[model samples]
Target: MRGAKSAKWVVGAVIVALAATACGGDNKDDKPTGAGKAGGTFSLGLVEPVSIDPVNAQESEGILVTDNLFTGLYEPTADGKVIPALATSKTVSDDGKTWTFKIKPGTKFTNGEIVNAEAFIRGWTRLAAKASASDVATPNVGGIDGFEALQKGTATTFSGLTAPDENTLQVKLTTPDFEFDVKTTHTSMSPVPKVAGAGKNQAYNDAPIGNGPFKMSGKWEHNKSITLVRNDDYGLTKAHLDTVKISILNSANAAQLEYQGFQSGQFDWARMPTAQLTSAKAKYTAQNEWIQADTSGMNYLLPITENGPLKTAKARQAISYAIDRDAIIAGVFQGMQTKSTTILPPSFKDVYQKDLCVSCIKQDKDKAKSLAAEAGLKPGDELHIGFNTGGGHEEWVQAVVQQIKDVLGLNVKMDAKPFKELLAAQQAPGATGAYRFAWGADYPTPDNFLFPLLDSKSINKDASGKVQGDNRGRYNNPAFDALVEKARSTKDSAARNEVYKQAEKLAMDDQALIPLWNRTQFRLVNTKKFTGGAMDFHEDPNLAEISAK
Candidate 1:
């Protein structure tokens, strides 16, 4: 889930959520047993989350916490199929701009509050406020009517959202979106209790009362651990595990520590560090203790476009041409990742263009030199590459820096900080030259991948010019924005995908963001002791489905 990475819209964005299996096929063996012996505790090792608040969860760690703490109108299965959870059924208007969902009756939060239509309405309105502030709001409801007014703080509630009855929730969108139900699967679209208030309520965020399969056992312990117990009153698929304990360890070698903990039988689930992936496979594969799943997350470099040494397209293209992704994957990642040449992953088969990034597929020192010189870069100029520490990124980022030095002959430096600090720096205008970032899918659509990360409209700036939107790099292109809009409105999947492909090409040709590699999730699990614990499309474990064997 950490590839939901240092940030989510850096992980969570919305063209609209797409069905994972339809777009990209995952491991067929990924099916976990839904019926298993219950009543066992499952322990996992994890990195610290920035926030567990669904509205503010922008990174992978935070997203994991929210995933367990809440259930939305629709929820995705392990393979990414969107199914009704809080809602039993849905219908669309003739024009396709209006949608009404029938909320499942009698569902209640752990706190005994009813999970009615108002709960979802309040939750979405609160999410809009957070999105307005440039905080992490996913499944961007920007398509909904009155969203702009709500986001701009001009409205107190969403005019598009209305409760016709206690169990009926209706939404009016400015544009027709047939896949709106799929977008409801996001945690950001989950219902929240009244105590969550209308903004960042620290008390509620610390100990959220959820209507999901699990409930927080106590308050979050912050850098230490967070515990969850099964919510017996859950209305949908009930959790089989009695308790889920997530131990947060954020040391410099956190992933290594997690692997060690797994070996010592301290954790039922753990992530394999890149340094030990090969040895882990050798040791665990024979025992069926290792699981490798494909996720839609993409690791890349985000260059500050507004200002910096990477201000020009040629400079960004030069950086993309200089790095050797194969060496990093082979030497640092132990050949566990796939090199990427485009914004969309291969899973988006209908729209993905393999060779769209002409300069990224292979390293070209001559091309790098020419582009660097064209952008007025000299051999000795200092170019800083910033990244988050303690997330198994230091090694690969160092390799990238070395390649840039060797290829462009620049005085490259590494700027490493804590994940939170690095995120802040990346969002600030020109605070750093370039920083590492990754994005995982919320749903399967190309719009989900393209619009939020590249659209100029998605770029919201504060008075001080810091990015408050998902467009952290603050790239502005009227032509690119037009294509994204065209795709957003097109109802036919094939035609829409064509427009999306064009948009992706435009951004890539400009070298808007340097594509590195697609993520392959490596996990360690005690298969003999547990059943039904598997990675979802976002690389998060299906904690609700896990049970003792």
Candidate 2:
């Protein structure tokens, strides 16, 4: 999932402090710049790239930029319900195998290309075509009928998809999927102009043509910074902002920027630095709004290689038992985390299993040592671990390595590499050993958590012919896979939950991956400058409703 998970809640906590600091402004008049202004510019500092292309993007920062510059057929509501965006309404067959959508009228791309039935066909077909090399397309559309066949080069046509008119599009599925609407909100479903850019993937990166409220003005240094000007041709007049500027700011310097007021009144909103939460609260007292919500995301220490000393199930369980997750939360996050018992967070009320705790791998140094010995590991076995300094809980990573070294009596080496390099290494097949990374919900479903992270088949050869991205660990268990598949195919929610519960138990017992904690979503917006309800899914500052005080 491309949403912020761990940092969202922490950011929300800081927002609360910001809200306390700044008070008494009506929510309506909190926008930093008055609506309809054309000259002033608002700058946003992001921890990652503000990439224009949706295919190669991975983080929420990039998605935020996409959301502002792109429009999809559907979007998710605050309650996790799907609502129309480019499409007016959709109808599903009683058996749930067929879906038909009525496209919204009078929509036009920024290039003045009138959106029609052909546009929908062209966009989806392009995404479905492996020749496009679209990363977002393959995963999101793989569930549709003939999609897999198309990707495998056995099919020339997408059997599941059809567009009969400029205003209507239809999809025929092989089986019933209850989460179809939720899936449609993904970026893969976003419409793009057919002749907007050249070269397969270069077009989206260089110039994006979407029927959104904003149009890409320019991109600098391959998405380090991006510029977007208001799409004056847009049909919606409610979008008050004239332009938006996004700048890439490393997490380390985010605090300094916020503390220095570089973004305070000049820009409407910016991520509050973790170290400045308290001080920001005191400084912006009564002029800010901070909110926190469970993001349904998990951060874990994943073991990459399922061979060697850590390959045995018992050995993995022992390693899990040795680390103190509570200490990591307190010391690293400053009490900003909830201990996770399972892969799915409690926010997913229906599918999150509360009863199953088969391998409640709590802190037990002695037990871990015994299990390691049982796996035939000598006292001097070398265990190598790695993490990324580019994103997430650096302190936690250091503390985990220390705990493993001290408790296991093993020689341990830890490598903290750059974020991008670490991501590349993690995606490389046959890479022995695991690293720490945060998993955010792509959608608000337990299937999102289990299928992508644990499924054996999710691994695939990237452009370089190396197995990459999800399923990097290459950990596989037939029992676990069966349970997940059963859960997916079964329509009965209760039955699916039961199967998922079993899957969770098996994952825990086998120690497939260590469950760290469910992260909280956090946003600190200066209420004096901007006002709107915060979103748990993404930081979507609704500009239409905001005004300058």
Candidate 3:
């Protein structure tokens, strides 16, 4: 769900430009399978992942690696449907609080362990436990009964989870949710093999044994690369490619380097740096090898509300009103990015509302100056903006800093740190006033965009009051929270979406976060060397379907 954290965020590109592109695979044989020439390495570029272990892998880089290494009970399709993968059938109770899943029998992890109901139980239980240090556990599975107990370390397992037999998993939730199956598609919910051992095991993180179409060929070479070979014993749709090779590039010029690698034949699929996008598209588009897609990711600025100059909504709105998104998108991103008018991305067309945030309009220097004056902020007041380096954010951040200075007559400071360090700073007590934020939907639902990222319950505070979780800005509105809850408990889809729209409106009215632009995935592929390589609904490469040309 963490998008920009991907290595230069290369591996997270989606596809909307090429309608004729073969993404999933060609099932021309009229059979439920993916088959093709099967013996060659398919190489691509990647940034070093934070962690590949299912419990801790939340960023796009780590999640991309995990997707190839493990197939969950369900897989997200290009059409935004959660289709059965490891599980065959699911049934729900009338109250909608109880659900049962029938796992595919005899499915084996690469290490020869059975991926049964107990494996899913153990994996989810570990993810929910605070000792596991999983970032996804609470946001994705907090609806399960006793989740709070696990977070407090008072329970070792989820009280709502039960394995009726080797193949059956029964779950009880504290509240009704129709999209529980969709949430299971997340990497953290993937079944962990028994060999993984317990409690954030490092060995397993290095080389995980998985039950997918591919398995790790060897231990992950940190800051280097990772290679995966086809899982010969995999039970479902077989893979067309024999191996997947991912090169890890984390230098400040990673985007430039990745583009160069693609040109030199070092990569079959590569992300185009914004600087080279114009020329790359001009050349590759003619060859039908260019890809520009609308991603579910959104880039924003979180104005820390707990303390600092941005404590008031007026100050935050002033900041939002000052920046020129169209100018930045055209000047810096080479017209490759779209200016965002709302918190929701373009992919959520049905539920998305135009100009949902009144403060989200284009740059209005007069408005910004007036709002800042009302908030008692003026010239010479130091405004700090925090961001991470090596993620293609510096140029835009500088542009934003300059705009704020010219419009509001404020002295702005740019605090840049490494990605991981920036994340630590965001969670610490009295964090930065404003920081860069990027998120991809964990699932294709309005709740996926709202609840975990904005809801009050998503924020976790320790004894000393250090805040953690996705609500990094610490913005809380009971009215917004109430609307989100109403939406979640609603069984009807149309009614649920209506409530979500209201919640978004309330949050935006408070200027919860400064919406910059919806993310656009840019890539150049060597069609001569690869086929069936395309981005799926999750904005992930469909590795299993790709084959060497």
Per model, state how many residue pairs clash. 8, 33, 1
lDDT, candidate 2, 389-503, per-residue tens: 4344456777888888888877777877655566667766556655776777666566666766777655655657565336666678888878777776666778778788788
lDDT of 1 by residue, 1-549 (tens): 225253222122221121221111112231222468668888887777877877766677877778877888876665555666777789988766999999877878888999999999988888887333636452367788988787777888899999999999999999887677877866778898888885657788789888877899989998899998887777666667889889988787778888889999899888866788888888888887777765667788988787879999999999999998888888998787889999887766778799788888999989999999999989999887888777788889889999999998899989888777877787776565788888877766777767668787667766687776677777888999888878767777788888888999999988898999976677777787887666655576668767788
Q: Residues 1-549, candidate 3, lDDT per residue (tens digit)?
A: 766543112123444333221222222331224445777787777767777888877777788788878878877665455667877899888777888999888777888888899999988898888777665676778889889999889988799999989999998999887778778878788898887766568888899888877899889998899999887777776677788889988776667777888888888777766677789888988887777776677889989987899989999999999999888988999888878878877777678898887766678988999999999888999998988766677888999899889888899989987666777788788785799888887777878778777888777776666664677788888899888878877878898888888888888888988999888787777678777766655556777777766
Q: Give the best candidate by TM-score.
A: 3
* Deviation from truth (RMSD, Å), model 1: 5.0
Top candidate on lDDT is 3
Q: After superposition, how far is residue 236 of candidate 1 from its true place, in Å?
A: 0.8
> For model 1, what is the error of residue 103's alpha carbon versus the real structure, in angstroms, after optimal superposition?
1.5
**Candidate lDDT (C-alpha), each:** 0.77, 0.61, 0.78
Query: In model 2, which range of ten residues has the least summed lDDT?
Result: 17-26
